[model samples]
Target: MLPTTRGDFWAEITQIGMDRLWMQRFHVSLPQVSTVASRPGRRSIGFLTECNSSPLQHCGLNVLSGDIIVNKFDLAHHRSGADYHLGTMSLPTDELDTAVEVIIGRELLKSPDQRIVHPHPALMSRLLKLHKAVGQLARDTPDILERPEVARALENELVHVMVRCLAEGASADTTTGVRRHDAIMARFEEFLEANPDRPLYLTEICAAIGAAERTLRASCEEHLGMGPIRYLTLRRMHLVRRTLLHSDPSKVTVTQVVTDHGFWELGRFSVAYRMLFGESPSCTLRRPAEQPNIHLSRPSSLTTAEPRAT
Candidate 1:
């Protein structure tokens, strides 16, 4: 178990199942990253950034007081703990994965083939301001976790706000090449949300966003940290999972819900969803009367669903 400080706001571990995934939450009275070890794998959403710390990723969105960072980690190589208030969400690892996939798909327009390798320091600086806004919100807003819907809404707003901020920053850039790159990402995200239920091909996405494959891919790699297809798939799966959990199972079949959310391959969707959430789609459908106790790695304040066993 990772160490915790006395008086630090935290959540008890809610569930630990077959897959090596868990959930927890913490408040940001004092900044720390003690929960890093729990996610031994890379590509996990380890923490979201808040206003207290620097924006660690390549894009320069300001760190707002109530803004969340939503950190994903590849535990294989731990980046140094850059100065930032990393907030952990209480959703299961799989849920986070699914959410990230959905977010990238719905929010990012870049292509997988385009690859940008280097980090942009200037962009990183701008992101810091957004982080600060989020942090301020967190500090001012009391009992965010108690109101799950409100909390989720705030999280979503933060993401959209950051995307807009990124676009603004890109517009200010003197280099037409970089501005075009930013435009592709912006347009891509817009296109994705508008067509969440449609099949998204790489060529279609790039064409719609009016970006070359290489440039779009590089922007995605640099800003969003994912390729196009994988990100879209994940986003679809996440939406499916959320629908399963929140909707009336009696009114919706698993296949219907998944397909409606843009998941065409049933078998592949089932497998990926299981790997991320630690349970089958059917599990989410079955509305249990009692919530199960579970364990999560991060602090307790930033979670949505109740953790369960596989």
Candidate 2:
């Protein structure tokens, strides 16, 4: 059970004998004046939007202020105002949301792990427009919670519409070969997992994946919500934190562990590690032994400059 500032929201663990999947729900209530903080995670099919008519900050990297709704395929980091609810279908990592109703609505009628790679600008525009429309409908539809069936129907309809829009406008990018995008991502993931303790350069990852730097970067941006190096660095940090808490500190020096995970620059690694985990690597090592668990804290506000909304 992680203790979020809002309260103690228990992380749920669903275990089928030995197989297990962890999930959690977070409901944050902030004073109207406070700025929402940015959080990170893996790509998920989930819904996150303002409730009770609040402005959305940093929508799509363009700071859009309005009641904006988002059904994101890739990972996102943002702040929000007003009370928000989240649900997770699988893991309860900081990267997952607890808005299961919204995720199921979108993913039920679509392919598994639906991802957009090399999305055409036209298609991206239409999808955003559809999202806006659905969000409006949701806001206007009153007493949705009063009738569960009606609420479910409406959510399902919105998902269907969004999926149709994506299918209609999506086109293959001839330059990158859209079909091979997933393969590249798989290779990248494998590489990251195998070398989680080593510092990795974007060029090195591109070489390992056998793709040009531009191509690799484009796909990473489209599918992972960040460039390859950023994603890998975060992943490495996550692993290192986990190891520090669960393994014997005497066996692994902090420098060796972090550098082995592909983080060559000591200063940068220390700063990022401290920023993400909410403590220095040395501090984590000195703490008394505890259960194996890791929670990557949201970065400080200064590191995230608000993007201009398009």
Candidate 3:
């Protein structure tokens, strides 16, 4: 994952593995691209674990509190505006597929379309409590889960609630406008990735991606909460940091790295870099590489991130 916001990134992650399912909790700082890729044989879902927190953007739509997003056959993108607390659960398709069909009177894997399911408030409350309880148990009293019967009961209950949510959820299908903008953003990202080392012009990007400037701008604003140029600069600032952190000072000069990433305005680049990273490029180059503090994460080259407007 790439760092989207300024300063050092921080996060904390916790996970518990069951016989066939896994539950995870993530407390992350900064809004960065978080993706769930289709496993082909497994299914996954994520939700806001905290009460009344800011909504996470799922394919350009806001995923409100208590709402769940289920991943389908393609890469799914989720972006947050700032710090977020989230929980997730996943199991093999075959494991829960049968249970879901039996209880819901429908097949879970029949459709490959990703979905946002808003479970009824009362039912979702129970699910969230159980999910939160499970996470709490795993953290403070993991030995309690060592009991086979206890573990089995929890897993069974978890599955039951999951199925109930799916059965009762008021599902929202992707709108035509959202889908079109999502596709445009995807194409725009592909183009940027294809030409990583060069300074990109907006006109050139629009032409190559076959999107009008206005559409591309709108897509970026919706998904990333920033305009294209702002995002590009934010993206490169972090890229430069990544390179500096890894490069050997004896072998590489800062200039080579900065220019290589397509920045030519050395005068302004230094100021922006310091403003975003809270350090001089040379200082970062000299410091030792450090691991991310706290939670779970990574950003993509084409990943979505929302930076505050200047």
Better of 2 and 3 by TM-score: 3
Candidate 2 minimal-lDDT segment of 10 residues? 301-310
Clashes of each: 74, 19, 7
Q: Tell me, by TM-score, which candidate is best.
A: 3
**CA lDDT, candidate 3, residue 297:** 21
Error of 2 at 253 (Å): 2.4
TM-score of each candidate? 0.46, 0.44, 0.83
Question: Which portions of model 1 miss their true places by more than 4 Å?
Answer: 1-55, 58-176, 288-310
Ranking by TM-score: 3, 1, 2
The candidate that wins on lDDT is 3
lDDT of 3 by residue, 114-153 (tens): 4788899988898899988987777666778777888889
Candidate 3 TM-score, true structure as reference: 0.83
| TM-score for candidate 1 | 0.46
Residue-level lDDT tens digits of model 1 in 111-179? 322222112444444444444444444434444433666556555654443443333232212245644
Which of 1 and 3 is the better model by TM-score? 3
